[model samples]
Target: MIQPSNKNRIVYLDVLRVLAMLMVIMVHVGDAYLFNAETMTFETEASLFAVLLRSSVPLFIIMSSILLLPIKKDNTSFFKRRFTRVVIPFLIWSIIYVFLPIPNEIAFGGPANTFTDSGLNVFLYNLMMVPFNFTGSNVHFWFLYIILGLYLFMPIISPWIKTASKRSLIFFLSMWGITLFFPYLRLYFPQIHGECDWNDFGMFYYFGGYLGYVILGYFLHHHNRLKAGQSMAIGAILFIVGVIVTYWGFIHDQNAFFKTLALSHVENWKLIEFNISFLSPNVVIMTAGVFMLFQNIKLSAFMKRVFTELSVFSYGIFLVHYIITLWITAWLHNSMMINPGLEQFLLTVLTFSISYGIVKPISFFPRSNYIIG
Candidate 1:
């Protein structure tokens, strides 16, 4: 049985995680709607839906940080374990996806720059590109690298983080500030990009996420002042507010007087756009909402059992599921051309079934369970 603690293990984190994973899957499925010739442009109804669903990615990152944070260990031990778990799978999949070119290209939309004639060899070189991320070759797997870097620094960072003092809070806020400002530096002050250090979380966006979830995780593990009911109420309110804000901004494109202030901005009112990926204020808002929902809510027996199982498979599900999405997209483009509605429905069903189904059997292999879980 899973043990509960005031500041430690929280069931709601897992619940939020499972929900976030499903949202990611749903976002990808919704993305398929875009591949349709009629819906390729920004103006189309389906395209707008795709844009709205982009929150799923940020949600996944936020949830991952929140869940992964409480797994406290020494720096060396933490690195060893996380490397064996998150990084190893990322590397293996990075290679497989590179050689096969089956799923990654489709899911992430090809290499950002040049593709070479040498297939396997070029991919190996691309794997070497992992550390720097200059070429942006390993795309999604870059997150694993970045997160691993954060984990490495956690030994030093954690002590400061745990201090629970004003100075520590300043440390975190300062980190958040640099993260927010760096991208702007790249845009307006191009020279800074060359001089600035590029560690794993140094990417700013990932750093913010790393900080947010880690802090939240620490807070959750250290404090249990709120009961489940309280968490749920807060979560519900946050979710409702988030929905209203997202819908107001994206769909209606009208900033109601109050909503305008709700938008992220510095003191001078230079608007914060596209910062969710980098841990914008909106992300913090949504994170609170998601966190509350998971903490406050209890699942029914059926859902509880299923979520338990699903959460077990989430790692593997995350790893190879995109491959399923890619193949589904391919199948639709190749064979399932008739009836877009049916094609989409069947494609989603088949993708989920195959991905989820394969996870268990594949997980049976030695040391494999860590890959997805």
Candidate 2:
């Protein structure tokens, strides 16, 4: 999910790394508003923002693909370096979140239900599941799993990536694009393209999931470097259209749900979330928009140095930032002093600062990269 500092780091990649992490923080911060809002039938800032911010994780994936695909290193070497930077730190944080007791609601005073188990017996049981799953409390870790899969696939696909013509890669992406509509297809028919409950592997399953983004990243890497103005102009249109489709789908679904469904199910909002599924076409468009828009960034000297450091510690901050997110966002909103519009922005900045502060010092200790990454 994160890349290491490189001797040949591209400026925009570093800048994009910082923006991607910040966008991730924004997503979490916005969730505080969404899950705790008074009504589910209407759009809030969080819901509006979710349409655009769904691109956050995909951006990271594309960036990882752009940076790591056509993998030069052997499998063992690549896994050694990537897993050390990602999985070990992930495991460490998983343990911390598992054992740490949050006996009260934290997400804008939403739910304290992350870790209900206590003591060694409970901790051991949860620890045993670490290799398999993370609880809803640590939902962000889901990205970690997707990324690990991509990492595993990277070396295996490197040869294909190296040899495949641009046309061939585009063909793969086109096939994957068909799979993007599978979720909707499931609504009208339980199965499609040779898929069923038993046959989860459909005709295009091989071409779907995050793998397309990996191929896209590599293909786009070889694309002609468009002028900054041209790229941003086109990217902005795609980004706006993506946002409109996502938001429209969200609002339409929410209104329909309210008309037919009872209001008691707080989690019913997930039904509405179906519209914004990250695997869908809207997100893919937004992801491409972000990839294009960021590639042309030109940072000043001082800002570049600052972002370079941020880029290095971004993964570390991501690991620890969620710990304080709900708690801080709740306080900010419950305070009633900060502008409602600004709560999310302030929460993102504050959480980023706090997480960065915590990780920066730990990064100095020996072997801490393996721990704090």
Candidate 3:
């Protein structure tokens, strides 16, 4: 069984949280290359690494569920605490990104200019639709919407999870496994369509989507009985399989696109939509495997301290990292002529370091935790 310390903190989870945040930076860094590829080629090692980084967001969701789903608090108290923690910081950062002077060429792929009157109005409109359509200001803000939706269901599911047996949890996971294939099923069979509509009551809806990862988090934390060796072995195998599937899937998609549309056009990048979804079965397995692998690690004192600090600032880092990424990547592109692969790697490091440097000091200010945590 999983156990927290007397203070109720799980150190391993802290490590996982830190790793997940770093992985998010990696994904954004990879985007600089993956999205801007000059040609339709998926055979590059950088592309494969980008595919591997797709697990980052799913891992974040899993970590959130593992920590939040076991709470015994009532819905009112839960919402009051959780919403305040996430939503306030979200709004603060959303507004910051909305007005930040970063040019669109760097921040996004538009012309090299700050917001125009029409752009500002559109940004404000999207902000006005908060908690529903958040992708307007920042694409990364989509995670907040998903988290908010999951939090809405947490109170209703918490009690059930507290009393749930292993078999029952397994059954739910199996149903979730089936739902993971829905994306691929739609790809091959476009006629099959429905939103978890089992009968009219949406009974299966409870067992679908990222909810499985949430429950998986709780289950793996509290109910896992696997030996350390066994867990690592299973995790390693799953991760390998996930990598193969993701790499091949994207390659196949890119080749098909190149063949269908002449390969001469850089604009005809078909591999853009071919990677495994975060909700794909491969990602689920990979995330579970990685989570389990980390669960069995014994961190050294120095490493533990580093992870603890990173975890504390992780939410803040997530909020601010994108701007740092855009600025740093733009500067690097303008000032230096380097390999795209090297640039991506350097951008990831610099973005994470600068973002952390900014957040670490802000974390000490009065009422800063509400903004950063």
Candidate 4:
């Protein structure tokens, strides 16, 4: 699972970050069609496509782990750097989203959850609650919470990861893998292995969630010894199997029309949550697969520079692209007579490019990483 490095840079990770960003946009684009459509036929099938992209956040987390694990800096420095790099930018944008009136009325008419323009009281409430959750606002902002938590937990686990043997990691991943199936397990038994209202600890309680991905990424980055061709082959198999399972499972459980990156449009959100949760086994498998595939990417010098720039702007692009995507989706749906699939493609392209254009310049301003990161 050890990641190979090229001269002075890890270009494959850069490529993965860019791919994840595009996948995220595609997820949002699929959401636009699913929620806006009058019925579920085309829109629902298309939205189901987002299951393939569910690994986007996991990819981001894994990339973070690969770069930050082993705790090169002290906890204080790590946290301080993370705070400036992520939390500050997140707050600025979140505040911007809360105050912006874009959600009140899409210029072309679409989703209002884009931003909060309800009133002073509602905006304040959302702002105040921002410290706690991302309720009644942009759902994508939820990534910030998960990432922040992972960052906090990083130092706690770093020592264990550094000293742990291969068997130790394997055991941890096995337990974590068991937790991945907890979503399906709960379908048959609600309180499995001591998980109940009074006591939330299950058999693999500590091994669940995105932390597994952190360790998984660490293990892969430092432990795997396979050649590029072999790794890619295995990655392809895993990714293909993952895609099949993810798509079929989500589609099988889904019949009623509903849809996102927000599943508010889906009438049966429980099914959506169960099969496509980012923490599920299938998604994790898919994440591991594509991540492995990306590890062996070949990049030209110019392209390497380009991917690096895109990676740097990726976080800001993520925060700002949603609004632009909403606008683009509404305009495309209202003005264009095109296939939903084609529209989604164009929507992802245009939104991603436009967001990059906006972020690249702002990223150069003084202390802008805090604002744009």
Candidate 4 lDDT by residue in tens digits, 1-373: 1123346668999899999999999887776665543544435556556877888989999999999988988999999999988999888888887665553342222223434455546667667767877744556787779889999989998898889999999999999998888777776889989788999897789988889999899899888788999999999999988888988777766543233324554334555557778888888899999988978789877788788878777899998997787767767753567776777778899999999889878876999988886
Backbone clash numbers for all candidates listed: 5, 1, 0, 7
Backbone clashes counted, model 4? 7
TM-score for all models, in order of appearance:
0.69, 0.90, 0.86, 0.89
lDDT, residue 78, candidate 4 = 93
Model 1: CA > 4 A from native: 1-9, 35-40, 43-72, 101-107, 114-125, 134-138, 165-210, 220-224, 227-230, 247-278, 300-303, 333-350, 370-373
Error of 4 at 122 (Å): 1.8
User: In candidate 1, what are the lDDT values of residues 1-373, reduced to their tens digit?
Assistant: 3222233334565666666666566556655664344632322444344443444555555555555554477667877877787777776766666555564343443234445554546656666765556233445454565566666656765555655665565566567656654654556765442354443333345445455555554554445357878877877786666555554444333223225755532311233123323354444556566665665566565666666666667777777767677667766643665655455556656666678788778777888845664
Clashes of 1: 5
| Stretches > 4 Å off in candidate 2 | 1-7, 37-43, 103-125, 259-269
Off by over 4 Å in 3: 1-7, 37-43, 106-120, 193-206, 257-271, 334-342
Residues 1-373 of candidate 3 have per-residue lDDT tens digits of: 1122233567788888888888888777665566434654553756777777777888888888888876767789889887678888988888777677663433433212234454666566546556555543576777788888899988888888889999999898999998787666656764443433444324355557777888888888888789989988988888888888887887777667756674433344434554566777878888887888888888766666677777877899999998777667666752557766666777788889899889878877998967886
State, as a TM-score between 0 and 1, how close model 2 is to the true structure. Answer: 0.90
Instruction: Show pairs that collide, candidate 3.
Output: none
- Alpha-carbon lDDT, every model: 0.56, 0.78, 0.74, 0.79
Best by TM-score: 2
**How far is each candidate from the true structure, as Cα RMSD in Å?**
7.8, 3.8, 5.0, 4.9
